[model samples]
Target: MSTPALTLHGVGKRFGDVQALHDVDVTVESGTVHCILGENGAGKSTLCNLVFGGYPPDTGRIALGGKDFRPDSPAAAMAAGVAMVHQHFSLVTTMTVAENLLLTQHGLRLRRQDLTDRLDEIAQTYRLRVDLDQQVATMPVGARQKVEIVKALLRDPSLILLDEPTGVLDPAEIDALIDTCRAIAADGKAVVLVTHKLGEVARVADAATVLRRGTVAGGGRMSTTSIAQLLTAMVGRTAADLDPTVAATIGLDPADAVTHRVGAAPTSISGPDAAEPRSITTSKTSVPMGETGSTASALTRAPIVEHGAESVAPRVDNESGSAAAVLTVDRVTVHRADGSTALNDARLVVYPGEIVGIAGVEGNGQSELVAVLAGDTPVSGGTVTLADTDITTANPATRTGLGIGIVPEDRHRDAMVAEMTLAENLFLGRLGRFRRFGLLDKQAMGRAAKAELDRFDVRAAGPWVPMGSLSGGNQQKVVLARELSAANLRCLVAAQPTRGLDIGAVDFVLTQLRRAATAGCGVLVVSSEVPELLALCDRVFVAYRGALAGPVETSDPAAAQQISELMMGVAA
Candidate 1:
């Protein structure tokens, strides 16, 4: 056979005392989609970085087509017929699609027309749809992802790596991506798909490899194994069946629970200094049912109502007693830079132990809502109360001090400082943990950061490397590790907490959100993906063209459908 497209032998990585990947070996055949499966911190992203030359491995040899291959940087990797489409879009928003696509043109400047024409041809040929003339920022998330793929394809790579390509896509968009991947493989390029979603694996992958604690757990053809078997290999256990109590906690009507995943793993709360040899269990330890006083606060009604029920009685939690709201927003209006309205008189509330989801189409004020909650932006007119304290006028720092942690919608631009070290990034504003006499305690910070990194499974070249150096998926883990470690948090504002994470990471993040709720903290998660909202939130509020259409209880289909239509701005 033609030399394996890419191979790694005795690959390993370590940070101070943690061994991220150890004596790992993997081989990818030409023109086939190879999958890397693992739970959060399983070193999936680490392996990708090493392959792409983000940095050299601590110990190992990488070969391409029977020859030793070593790329010094991303540019070198591209030169060696390897390309990566990061979990985060790397295109500059201000640049036109063509300009970004052929950015490196030549040592000398090239004609813009030539670049655009060539880009158009390539786009059409690959069936990767994108408008060459459009400014990248104007495109939706799914479209932007397409641009990233186009950029990679332009390099004419023989090996392509897609890092969590479906994380930000809607259900329909995911289908398109699946088709695109199929086409890419058909082109005879070796493809490495790094993701944690088992469904995605079942849908598009050919052969599969499982990584656990930085080592290869197993490998097999996708067609020969079941999703449950994959999960067992990745997490080192037969994945736990969803606890019936979890379905009740999320207010899933028993009927609805049957269709969706119930009681999988929870989101991760560990920091960057997480231990090496990551745990295989993806689910967080479940909060004892009703411990947060949520047992009687909400009721679950069947998705289908009995024909004789009078007007469908509202589900009420008998155990939930009247309690002061921790977060309250009233008649809030958000406006664009040009004075156009984004959110008009929208209102919402969340009590402690409640996880509220705000769902809408892209560009429908979801970003604005997250900004306002995180105190990154000021609302034009509204009341925002946190623990009965008016925080409408608070700054981002103040809100954070008041015990609100935010996993922003745009992890790169809003949440992370690219040039900073992992340790510094994690301790962004809260330096108390590593400050001495008002001076930064470097040693303490590194140690602390290492602990969180291992705990959260954040993959990076080194703790001190610039944040921008790691893969997008790993960067997201850094953001999660930092924000969730806030000990005094009373509430959290997470916008797409699992945006670029793999299936294992997805489970870890959801579990963390549940943990926060169980600890009596209020959580407001805003996402465009409806299924994510359905799976994680205790209640969902639909937004349409900036209006708070309806706060739907997740108990029945009628309420969810009503909210769904409102999300489309349809009349009830």
Candidate 2:
């Protein structure tokens, strides 16, 4: 093909002692979608950063159209016709969409009128629509992501790097993104997508590369590779020993069930950002650790699920009085602090010993529902009953007291205080009993925190260390341990619990949630990942336009397809 659009030879990167990427080689031709697939810390992001110049590679050569290419910064990369759309948005939450759009161009060169006109022109040209005057903070997650994509496209880069861009998008929005990439490729641009979601890779990738432990495992023309082959490559397993997909492809075989194998100390790997690479922390809680590839880890890590995530397990109705619901919401309505209606008569129920899911496009009332259930938000109407007690007006503390535990959507903002010690944050809400004679008992709290953290196997400098000192997965472990282990925790609500976690952490969190349900806690899992919801939830409900749809049983073979239609505003 006419000189590959981008190429790397023997590229390597290191963050301190972590070798994030080693001898990496990749090439992208124009007019194609090249997918870089890997588990978290598999060096995907490091490669992207290497190419984008967030940090220079430790060793390597980069070429653009057969010419020497080296960039000192992201701006220089963009100047060379490369743009990156990060996983998390970088927009000014306070700015109007139109303003954000205009700021990218030369300052003072375009009037507001000109910017609006440009937005309109691009909307028509790209077949993408966005509200120009709306504050990004108020837009739905899907819309905000669309704005991010538009921001990257506005620069008209010849090569685009998309990092987990569809993590928060709905099926329709994801399809739109794929179509846009195709349109861009048709115009001879190159698209490099770095993602852990195997289904997306199977659907949109023209060529694929798999990374494991910062090294390329295998890759080839997408047409020549089967999903099974891709999974085998990504997880370092054989077709028979292949695990999750192997089970799903035939049928879930408990005898064949597998978990992550024990991996040693944190190695050099790509992490959350360019400055810091990821590290591994072994949790030694009571829970049995899985092999190198645990069932949950393998399933979430690979494209094992036919629909792209794990599918249903038998509903476990093992709680006392199993038929009785632990939590119920009747016609709940919620308004945002900004005065926008968030949930309109949203309703659902969580029965003991069962996992229920709230599935929808991001920004479609899932967050509000979680807040309302967690007692963090005030309701405008409707009633929430916890074990037959009216809790609509209960405060967060009251909810917690009534056995309502939440692993909030934003763990940092709602679940834990980053600046506080891990012990302090773990026992933050339930500190009343720790006080003795109106005086705080430091020794008692320390002992309790250490015992509890050790039980959850949360690795940290010590219980005295800041909560933020741990990795994302370990941080999540702290949350899961606290909530699930709470006294009289009859029900638990977790929102996007695995949102930013790696496969190892994802597996651990899901396992904990399941065990909590098995032990009689009603569990509510709110996530944008349909595959996850399909795989783990016993029952799934679609949240759309601030409303809850049918509670589809996950046991149905077509559950994923049905959920997709419901999320897209169609009745399954």
Candidate 3:
């Protein structure tokens, strides 16, 4: 097949005591799309880093087109005809999209008009339309991803590495990306897509390689392997042999139903099947604790829903009660930086002991909605009330004071200070708790941080290490630990809480949210992954152009499908 584009033999990597990758081997042929699949922290990023020259491998060699290739840095990697689009965005939020696009291509001063024209052409060619002149900070999550992909394509590299590039894209956008990769391959370039989503791999990949704990466990043409086979190779287990206890604890039940609808209004939580034992009572406090404050480590046992169970039909709330809505949004509108509107007349309400889910395409103003709820952005026009208090104009700190918790979509950037030690970052919003006569109480903060780390079962070298030193999954736990610590939290706003987390971490986070809802805390969850929203939310709201569509019962798959269509702007 005309000399493989890239190859690795016995590649290994280590960071201090952590063996990130070990004895891995992989090969990519010319002009083909190769997909590498693995769970979070299964050494996928480590392998990519090694190939891109982020660091030298502890052992082994890399060859490009039958020649030895050792890139010392990302620049060198690009110079060797390799370009990569990272899963985590690295754009200058303050810069214009045109300016970011021009950053990669050199030799010509970027004129505003000229840059715009070029970006327009590129976007049209790839079906990735975006406002070239808009500030990235004001654009939606999907638009930012377009910028990243455009940046990589501008380089015209012979080999491209895309890391979970579709995590934030809509179905249409995903199709466009897959088409773009295929077009790249048609041009005789090699594409390596590293992702955890098996469905995407099955659709777009020509060949598949499964990685497990730092080694390539299986490799074959995509046509020869089924999704189940790929998954078995990735996790080293057969579907039938998967233990229910492990699946339940790690959040990997094969039968777990996801509740995302595409084109209809949000589904209701009421139906005969809705009475299932997911959560028996809405107000559940009195969480059981272990001796070491490590609740997560002791969660290996099967979960049991013990409170009063209801039927699966949607809950019809027509009450005129006086209990304050923990969160309230009135006629809010979100505008794009380029004068386009994202959401119009969008309203939201969250009461105690309730979980409200916002389901839609990746963009559709979900990120902005979360920001508005968290008080990070000013609503264009609307009133927001928290615990019967008007918090529409309040800042982040004020919202926090009103017992609001936020797990932002971008956990590494907006949620955690990665450069700081774990303990220091954990104590960030809890300054009052570590203060003693105006002095910082280091011991108290450490004790508190230790408790959270144990409770979340965050695996790291040590609590004293920088937060960035841990894996992606553990980094998410840090954000969750801090957000869920508000002693009297009336509401929680979690955006894509399990985006990059592993099964174990996903289970822990979902369980915590359920527990919070049971404890009279209203929770608002926004996610692109429908299954997650289905499993955790009490009711689902499909947002389209900033409007809430449904409030539909998830028990009926037909109704759920209708809602899914509505979410994607599809007509029934």
Candidate 4:
């Protein structure tokens, strides 16, 4: 038999007190896509980094083509025919695609024209086309991903590792990426895909390895191993043991018989006065999460059907227009620095005790709308009102003071300072509240932080630990804890709150939003995941070409089709 492209036997790694990877074993053969399946902080990324020479394994061995392999640096790994594309892109946003590609080449001097020609050839060969001269910042998420792939391809490596590459991609883009992966593997090169997305694995992977708590759980050929088996290994729980909502969210089989309680209202996860638990068999034809079609329809079907003596219905009359709105955006229009309208006459209202969702493909004015709502961008034409108080020109602090909480899309950049302690991050913008006289009351802040962390179920060493030390899920928990725990919070505008979270974390976030709504707080969620919106929101609106379309009721049988058409700008 031909030697495997790569192998890791008894590999282990550690960072500080955390054992990131332990006793892990994996093998990738040429001409195959090998998937690394795990939840966040399950050592998927750490395993890839070990192979890419980002860090040396604390123990055991890695072999390339049946030969012992050890590299001191990423450059050495590249020289040995290994390339990696990180979850967070490393491209220079200020530079053009061609310029970024050129930076990856090793030389004292090189011809830019030659590099451009080579890039064009590779693009044509792989069918991953992108404008060579377009600035990285100006390109869409899909285009930027293609650039990263092309950069990795340029190395002509024996093995290429992609870490959570579809976190931000739309459906079409995800399909395209799957095709690209097949093409790469067809060329007799090994592909290692590190992701928690089970659907992607089912579509593109030839074999998969499951990791849980930094140890090898299970793995096998895709044809023989069921997705349920893989999921069981990853989470250490069978599909039957999971809540039906969570099981569906993480792409379990539609036929799985699972039961969960329904609250007094269809809009909430569970009402504050919810009755005894009930069992209901879901539809056999229900669309699973991460599937390519009609997820909104699948999730919304029979959402609140009458069961015997219990009749689940809407308790909160948000659409009646009787209760005062917590947030109102009226004819909001925002222009980019280049004089182009980023948000065009967008208008929406979030009533107290309601959860509203904004859904669309990325770059369809969602970011601009979020910025406008966060008071980061000034609206060219609009009036934003909070509880009858007009605050169109209010700054971020003023908005926060007026009971508007924001959770930005890019958490690391816009939300929290990673280098700071968890305590500091919890009280980031509201340091004054924790101040004792003229000095900062760090002790009080730490105590409050600890309480919040425990309340939010954020798993971490301590409040004194750096915020960056926690996993993506834990970090998000901190952010949510901070925003939701605000004493004066009346409205929460969260953009992609569960963008990179695992299935468990997604459940937690959705539950938190529902609880907030139950407590009379208006919630606005912006997300690219249509199913998530349908599953959690009372009503969903699509953002299309800087315009708003449809307050489609989640219970509408045709809601998914309507949202899809609106997203494509085809709705009349």
Candidate 5:
């Protein structure tokens, strides 16, 4: 038999008091896509880092192509034919894509034209196109993700590790990435996909290993292992114990949601009312997985909806439409830093006690809209009002003072400082509030932060730990805890609130949003996941080409279809 592409036996890693991974065993053969599946803090990233040489294992052995492999650094790993695409990007934000790629080359004096040609060649071969001269900082999260993929591919490694690659991609982009993974494996290379998304595993993975709390819980060939088996292994719970909404969110059927047979016909998994499943496909003619059909079909479908009438959590009554609007964007127009129009004639209204959602493909003016609302970018034309007060020209600090809380999309870059402690991050913009006698009252701030962290169920060492030390989910919780705890919060603009969270974390965050709305705070969520919008929002809108579409009520049976059409610019 041919030697496996990679192997790990009894691998264990520890950091301080935390056992990140322990007694783990895995093998990846050539010409196969191996998935590392687990929830947040399940040690999936740790395992990937161990292989990519981001960190060293405290025990056991790893081999690459039948040879002992102990790479002290990422450079050594790359030299030994291992490349990695991190969940959080690793690009120099100040540089262009071409320059970033050039930095990864072996020689320091390589010509730019030769590197560009090589990048173009790899991009064409893998269908992973990226703008060569685009600044990494200016690109959207999805675009950055593509650049990362292309950068990894440029290495021409035998094994590539992708950590949560699809977390930021749209449905069409996701389909394209899956195709890319398949192509890479077909070319006799090994692919290691680290993710918590079950639908993705159903589509692209040849085999999977489930991790729970730093140990291997279950694993096998994708053809044999059932979705229920995998879910149970990851969370230590049966399908019945799983929340139906979460089950549907992650691409498992609420009833008999077990097997996701690849290439099988669409499965009509019953929704709340057991209505017939509707046929919905993405703009790329691919079906989205985990909605009402097979994983592939469900993933390709654009309109994510329940089989029957739209069922959402109980929300405060806003049907009267008589209440004064808490936030209003009237014909708002925003210009990009380059003087190009980013948002044009965009109008929206959010009343008190409502959860409003904005859904669209990335780079469709969503970021612009968020920025305008957050008071980061001034609107070139039109008025923004908070509770009948015109604040179109309000700055970020002014907006925050006016009870407008913002949870920006890029949490690490725009929301929190990684180097700061949890207590400091929790009170980042509002440090003045904790002042005593013209001095920073750090002790009081720490005590308050600890209370809020406990309230939000944030798992961390304490308020003194650096915010970067927390898991993605825990970090998000800290952000939410800080924003939602505002003394005068009236409206919240949360962008991609649940982008990379685990199932449990997703549920917690959504519940908090709902709770905030119930407490008479207007909530606006911007997300790429249509199903998430459908499940959470009372009314959903689509942002396209710097414009706003319908406020499609979630109660409408055809809401998903309408939103999908609006996103694709084909709304009737």
Candidate 6:
């Protein structure tokens, strides 16, 4: 009898206070896609690390090809026919795609031309497209992901592990990735898909393994298992707890109501791929896993209505000619990477005491709008007024000074200085308040920062710890601590504020944003999560190619459906 591609026997791991993984058992069949589902810290990475020689389990054992597989290092794992594409790319930014692919080769030296040609052949076979000569740093996220996958495939490994493969990809890119995965599986390789999304499990998983709090909850064929059962395992909560109102009755925040899930979970195990996991392509695609698919189809296929600006942009700030709106963007047109208009005549008015959402699929110019409004991007043609102050041409510092705070989409890029201490980060933009008579007042800043950090429930060693030391949720809280605590904060623009946050942090952030809104701060939330918009926004505007659609009332029952339609460019 042939051995399973991989096997775990009562695997357990520990790191001082935390048991990262415990009594975990898994079996992956060759030529099949096996999905390992879990919450953020549910030991998914720990389990993968164990298999990849990142670390060894304290108890039990792992076997590859029915043999004891205790790898000494990641290199040893790769040497033993295993390759992994981690959530974070490990490519050398200075090198070209062809160069990065061949860097790890031991003695098999090939000319540059030969290497490029080989890469091209592999890319063509897998339907993965990447520039051969372009530097890895120059590639977009989706393109870079393709390069990583192709590089892994170049090795022709028997076992491939993808860790959150589609975290940064757009929808079309996601579809392409899913197809690529299917193609790889078709080649009879064993694939371990680690993700938090059930939709991906529903669509492409041949087998599903649920991990809850460091242990295997259950396992079954995708055709036989249910999302409810899977979500229950990962979250330690039932499907009924997913509904905000239902959970609210039990005293839970909307964000906390759902466990690690971003959107909602599928009621049953059904979608595009409900059959036994088979090659999606000759239709192979890949994504990290499901981005969670409760609203996946609706969001991707949401009707897109392309009407003139006169149709969508009908709201006036005030009929009496008063500056009633706290934040007003009129006829904003921001450019794209290709120098096309990303925000074409986009108009909106975010008044005090209202939480407004900009909802759409990823990359419909939400980043451009955030940049332009945050004063990071120059407006090509538009007038942005903040409390009647025309700051259209103002720089970021100037706008920030005028009471506009931004929680950018990519927090590592726009929000915090990773190397700086938590206290230093907390008082980053507003250091003057901490300044003493003749020099920097470190004492005052530390005291104030510590106070706020505790108040915000940021789990940190201390204010002296660098911002990078904290987890995603804690880091986000620190960012929020800085922005929301600003004395003159009037208008807040948050772009995907909860993208990678855990449930608790998400709850805190959402609650704070709502609190800010209640305090009469004009808040603009730009997110791709339909449920988030519907849950928090008083009114939601769907963005399509820089065009802002209806100010759909959240009170309206069809708000989510309408927003989804607008995201897909449908006239509702």
User: Highest TM-score, which number?
Assistant: 4
* Alpha-carbon TM-score of each model against the true structure: 0.72, 0.78, 0.75, 0.89, 0.86, 0.76
Error (Å) of candidate 5 at residue 230 is: 2.1
Global lDDT for candidate 3?
A: 0.69
Worst 10 residues of 2 by lDDT: 283-292
- Cα TM-score of candidate 6: 0.76
User: Which RMSD values do the candidates have, in order?
Assistant: 9.8, 9.3, 10.2, 6.5, 6.1, 9.3
- Model 6 has a clash total of 21
Clashes of each: 32, 14, 39, 0, 12, 21
The best-first sequence of candidates by TM-score reads: 4, 5, 2, 6, 3, 1
Instruction: Give the 10-residue window scoring lowest on summed lDDT in candidate 6.
Output: 277-286
Model 6 has an lDDT value of 0.72
C-alpha lDDT of residue 6 in model 5: 97
**Residue 462 lDDT, candidate 3, scale 0-100:** 65
Give lDDT for model 2.
0.72
- lDDT scores for all predictions? 0.70, 0.72, 0.69, 0.79, 0.79, 0.72
In angstroms, the error of model 3 at 252 is 11
Off by over 4 Å in 4: 108-117, 238-280, 283-297, 300-317
Error of 4 at 461 (Å): 1.3
Model 3 misplaced regions, further than 4 Å: 89-106, 109-144, 154-156, 217-219, 224-226, 232-325, 332-343, 379-382, 387-390, 393-395, 436-438, 568-572
Q: Give the per-residue lDDT digits (tens) of candidate 5, residues 1-572.
A: 99999999999999898999999999999999999988899999999999989889999999999999999999999999999999878999999988887886575565788777877787677777888899999997778888888878877899999999888887667777788899889889999998777777878889999888999988888766766667667765544443334544564434434434444433333324232322222222233333323321122211222312432344555753778899998998888878888888989999998888898888889898888888777788999999977888888888888899999988989999999999999887788888888998888888898899988889998899999988898999999998999899999999999888887677668767877887889999998877667666778889988898989886666666677778888875
- Residue pair clashes in candidate 4: none
The sequence of per-residue lDDT tens digits that candidate 6 reaches over residues 1-572 is 67799999999999997898888889998988999877566788788889999988899989998989999899899989898999888988998877786776664476677767777777676677777789987677888888888877777789999987865665556668778878778888999988655555656788889887798886677656655556556654453323231222112222322332223342343444232211110111111213333331111111111222211111222222343888999999888667877889899998876788898776677788898988888888979999979999998888888899999988998899999999988888677887778688888888898899987889887899888867776898888888898888999999888765544455467667766775778889987665566656668898887788888876665565566667777665
Question: Could you tell which candidate, 3 or 6, scores higher by TM-score?
Answer: 6
